[model samples]
Target: MDVSKEAKESLLVLDKQDGNKVKAVSGIDDAGKLKTVPPRKEHEQDFLKIDKHSNILENFFSNFMRQVKDPTHFEFFKIKTDDVEKVAPVIETMATQKDTASQEMLNEYRVEPSDYHKEQQGYKPIDESRIDWDNLKQFGITREGLEKSNSLEPMLNYQKSPGLHRISATFDNVKVDTDARLAFRETEDGRIALAVHGVRKQPELDRPYFGNNFSAEDKHNLLTTGNLGRVLDMKLPNQEKPIPVFLSVDKLTNELVSVRADKIRIPNEIKGVTLDENQKAELRSGKAVLLDGMTAKSGKEFSAEVQVNADKRGIEFKFPENQRQTQRQENGSEFKIPQKLGGVELSDKQQNSLKDGGTIYIEGLTDRKGQQYNAYVKVNDKEQKLDFYRWNPDKAKEITPDNKSKTQVEVNSNGKTNEATKEQKEPLKQGQTQADEPQQQQNKPRGMKM
Candidate 1:
């Protein structure tokens, strides 16, 4: 098993004697030597143990992943099964494939060759008398090493077991089960895909039928935990769409436990935004992160450079107010929508739109200091689609009293302003419809309601 360079760097090396306690960290030096550092008294333990004969790079990942508990750097979600009915079919396919794949692989990739014709056709023996043993010795090629080589001793020379065998892989302390935590990976298309971890069984089976020798506690854990395998692609019972979440393993108990998926969580998990380390640094410099995959009220997807919201305050997904719905063929390519904003609590209208993969345009959004603007929001939309029209701010019309010919207005009793009215301004261009006017909104009066 080849571990990725990132995973290798994230792991720490340990001695098995430390038990659950991480004693020291080890890594491969540039010279291909094992580098070890004793545990600092104040440092946290993260590495797993390694046996004396094991390769440092290969074994480090195997140990560290199994022993390390509750990863701090990663986000987790306490995901419960939403719709088991929607997930069962997927599980059945996975289970069937698991069995089918095992047999196919055993036949396709046998450790031993299928046919022994080459071995039966033995190679000509080396002429010992003509061979210069002293000269070979000078080059460190000893007769003992040569005799042990596979060329001199083939399986055809001896009677051995016939037929193919399937070799099951096992990891010490790592238990395989039907249930697993899913890790999300960002795809080239800007979508997030689920990468499962901590389990080896198919989604259909609640328990692993092969590979694992179960203990009493293992059996107990299997029965108690809920499986998310089937629901990875299904929408939550309450949410408008499916979300990717990760599960964490407990170091102390070696069990799957509830954790928050930081990426999708509210304020506490707002850091789950596409803001990586580099993006965070840029955000600190008052730069906006251009994120994608958000849908607008008109079923058009758009992207924007979102400003990083203050920490501790929750972020929001919203669309601007009174946005006209237009089909893609109507020369509407870009949706001037805010993908992520800072706020908490969705209005009833916004929640309803999010429920059905629809979009919401919320007018009169305010910050803590009473500043106002509008926003557009959508739910259950694709992550990274690029074929929509770009929003042209210059073409947007400022909504004012001059653009109020369509709506009837009521005057006050005193002939003074009874209702708040926008400033009267320029008239519409000849033959231009109201729809052709730009749709830019002005900040509402402090106490005015839409």
Candidate 2:
């Protein structure tokens, strides 16, 4: 009784008895519209007041089926892929019960691709578990090596790893080092096999990026800072007009990353004071702006400069310490770099390297909760401060939201499965990471996309 209002096509109920032969009571007519047979003599009274646009649940359908006198009739309904989960159960109960009708209904709908889609070549996903992980031992690599370097997941998903890797292998009786990434390809024998990406000497930046032509300055900005520093209009394939995008470079791989600029929603207020249109525009343009009368997390007065950073794909604070001159970053003649961070003492050599704008891996850095974790640290020489990243920023830039690996277990690409509703005969709605249910028996339709 509770169905989505978006439901359009109702189930085509077919019932007839001809002794072991399946009698067709409804089918597609000459005009391609659904044609259902007229109700029999026993149900004529209920059909008299029913109109084409009527929702028959309240009275007509409720009373009409009980009048059928067929002793051994069977029912079948052609349900659509989307509406099956919502309307099928009601049909099942009514069709099977002896007091309701003299028959049972078998769901005839199965979830295979439509004929038009299957006629052409279709992509079939491979099960990664069937792969032989020990095959990489020849190259002195193991499954653990691929897992640690973030390459295993992509290969399992039939994609190339985002960044290149250095591995030692032998060829022509000579051992040499090679830089490459991993992928999976379907063999002629229909088995998933390992593939290695051939490397180019450099990235091909000559081609247009989403229909946006690159200038000399644009190339320079990307090469120097890894960010384009501003949004640009970019037209994607099949799109009529260009959309605004924040562009950056994956430094390790040199692949360009473009995120939709308009998707970023800036809050009306930050800390305490509301920002005007001018300040918001400055942030969107990737320019830093200083704001006063703001508050810090410790309930103290603070003021800082904030700007949009493409690498992080969000707003970041530049001079957030507290009550300090926000313009000091511009003139750091008297500013000094720290010798230690988060109470972890640095050796003189490491401190000097940080002062010289070098990145170093640091461990034993304590958080507010007293938990210690390792991090990559670099000197923000212009800001006279240190910056920390959980992963090396050079390699991490390639792991964007658009390029993230979909979790291996889920079958539906557009939507997720919910484990709470796993046993139900319904499809998952959207954004669920777990399946609606597991298939305990073979060849049973779990109502989930396989």
Candidate 3:
């Protein structure tokens, strides 16, 4: 009998039932006799594993379930009046896309203290949306004939020393004067802050408005409504897109001081190198190109040089020294090197440096066809541009092995790296091994030996 090793090593086996109960046979001994072992009881096996913590946990769940089963033990909480008052306008606003302004609106526009107090006391509350526009004239607010208020003034403000973290601001003359200045600093939690000098105390005002455009009449309307705030936008060099900036105001001084310009969008595509009309049209929107070729020795004197232009950077690479035979497969046409060829990449620090205006050097990039090249990529934040150049030994800095590490070329922020594995083919030998020798055919075994 042919038995598997696992079957022979099994501790117990089930035997044929003599009546209702099955017999348990222990493993075969050296003499080949089966010994009987008794079956385990439920409490003996399960209760031994239970501990004090498990008992406590079981009792806790049992008590919770028992209490929940009692209808009289139910509990709930009452909703507050203020919360209901707040939620009504939000629901109304969603149903009808108009400002209901609820009680919070009056608070934001700084309604008279007496009126606010009456509203909070649950008496009559003011509703801004319900107010008539014609009655606004009675309150001394004119859209057309309103002149510029001397109450507001502008000043050039700087943070730390002069020239850094600087921006122009408009302040209320009744509170902050032309000599007044404000400085803003960002906290570790990513909040903008304000500090004021040359004022008795900060003015009482609402939060500043962060917007792109506001006419003179718009300013008048906002100021009259007690809704005055800051406005800011940035137009960067070489790019037509204007990014919106958020600013904070000193409520006590009524001075607009700080703006945090954090969100700058780089175009998904930009103007780069173009070859054909199709390529040119694609590149005008900032598309990248994949180059193919191999490194080879040129001339009878055998000077090694890379034949292909792998990137937009104008760098030429040589064979063997910069690139090695790293793999055998090709991922795509752009990745023209064999799977075995090793290439360089940008380090983590180098990538971060690029975002802040720095260059990353890459070398020893070989295509599947055994071509090699070097590249230099420049990062410019102001232009929102990344410029690529071919590696030039004469003009560019020579990268040492320690300075350059292997990385895939990043086409764009959202684009994945054209990465590949490094598995090279061993050169074929001219001679054969003993395994290749043919063996004499032996006569078929006349049957298995007993």
* Per-residue lDDT over 245-342 for candidate 1, one digit per residue giving the tens place of the 0 to 100 score: 33222221234432223332221112112234565454333234455654333334555444322211112222223222222222132222233333
Question: Which prediction has more favorable TM-score, 1 or 2?
Answer: 2
Off by over 4 Å in 2: 1-207, 223-225, 251-254, 268-274, 285-305, 317-450
Better of 1 and 2 by lDDT: 2
Better of 2 and 3 by TM-score: 2
Across 82-168, the per-residue lDDT of candidate 3 in tens digits comes to 232233233333323334654343222111212111112222322323333354344333223122211111111113211111122
Q: Which candidate number has the best lDDT?
A: 2
Q: What is the TM-score of candidate 1? A: 0.17
Give me the runs in candidate 3 sitting further than 4 Å from their true place.
1-342, 367-369, 379-386, 390-450
Cα lDDT tens digits, model 2, 236-305, are 7888888887786644455576668875655445554457779888768755678887655333455677
Error of 3 at 122 (Å): 50
Model 2 error, position 255 (Å): 3.5
- What's the ranking of the predictions by TM-score, best on top? 2, 1, 3
